[model samples]
Target: MLYWFLKWVAIGPLLRVIFRPKAYGVDHVPAEGPAILASNHLSYADWLFMPLTLPRRVTFVAKAEYFTTPGIKGWFQKKFFSGAGQVPIDRSGADAAEGAMKSAMKILAAGELFGIYPEGTRSHDGKLYRGKTGVARLALESGAPVIPCAVVGTDVVAPTGKVFGQWTRPVVRFGPPLDFSRYEGMSNDRYILRSITDEIMYEVMRLSEQEYVDMYASKAKELTKAAKEPVEPSDATSSAKKAS
Candidate 1:
């Protein structure tokens, strides 16, 4: 299959040689059966390096745009993403979040590893942000143990904007599986979901040793972009006129 070929022959081998990612607690990964690999999304390479370090295939719920772009670059992106065990789902509709959860749940029901970034998006400032509760919902719905994962130094390897950049050895650490069996059947409870998500993120913070930001990563990016935008002279004039 394309996955094996890419993993053993094409990309994975090359990445391992170049980046030389060092992974710890790989044994914590279940040798078989279903589980959630919930990780901090540091950079685009987080998906690549994490799976490259594991023998078991990890299926990530990726955005449909990764597979639907037009052009030669789009072709390659689709191929590479597919080869990396990514499944694309339309993440724009109102049910987008539920759609992603269904895809992951299907993978878990079939007794496979489901990888997810609970942070929803990569951290722009390298601080671990508050995780979305979808991951907790997945764990509860599928009755799978959640393993907290920390991928360090990947941001240096492939930063936010650049496709590839300065090489830095990344380290991946897998914390013990978290069991939320006590909170079974409480997936519909928003408070319970928040608590479960926060607990998993706490473990991820300990493993990655990164600063924790209570806000969501996407919100932080929006705030940063807004702050950087120049105040237009037209807007300034309009404000002055209103004051007058």
Candidate 2:
């Protein structure tokens, strides 16, 4: 299969030679069976280095646009993402969340590893953000254990919003699998979902040693962008007039 070929034969070996990435606590991953690898989203490279260190293929959901774009470039993009163990999901509409949940549940039903970033989006400033409850919902619905994972230094090798970055060894760390059987059949309970998500994020924070931010990563990015935008002179003048 293209996935195995790329990981072991084509791209994997080259990355190993160049970056020499190191993995710690890999034994925490199950030898077999379904599990969720919940990790902090620091950089886009997190997916590459994290799965590279694992023996099993880890599947992550990507926006459907990546696969649906038209043209020659889109063809290659689709193939590359597919070979990298990414599946496409339409991340729009009211049913988007449900659709993603179903996709992940199907993977778990097949006894495969499903990778998720509970933060929902990559951190803009390398700080761990509040994890969304979808991860908790997935674990409870699928009856799969969650493995807290942390990948450090990926931002150095592939910084967000940049094409490429300096080479540096990235470290992937895995913590013990979190079992949520106690909350079985309670996935619909929003309070329980939030509690479970927070527990998982706590472990991720410990493993990554990154500052924890109570805000969502997407919101944090938005606020940061808003802060950077220069205020219009008219707006400034209006504000001054109102103050006077």
By TM-score, the best candidate is 2
Clashing pairs in 1: none
**In candidate 2, what are the lDDT values of residues 151-177, reduced to their tens digit?**
999998889999899888999999999
Model 2, CA-based lDDT: 0.93
TM-score of each: 0.90, 0.93
Q: Tell me the spans in candidate 1 whose CA falls farther than 4 Å from its real position.
A: 68-77, 90-94, 232-244
Scanning candidate 2 in windows of ten residues, the lowest lDDT window is 89-98
Q: lDDT by residue for model 1 over 104-181, one digit each (tens)?
A: 988999999999999999999899999999999999999999999999999998899988778799999999999999
Question: How accurate locally, in lDDT, is each candidate?
Answer: 0.92, 0.93
Scored against the true structure, residue 15 in model 2 reaches a CA lDDT of 91
What does candidate 2 score on TM? 0.93
True lDDT of residue 116, candidate 2: 97
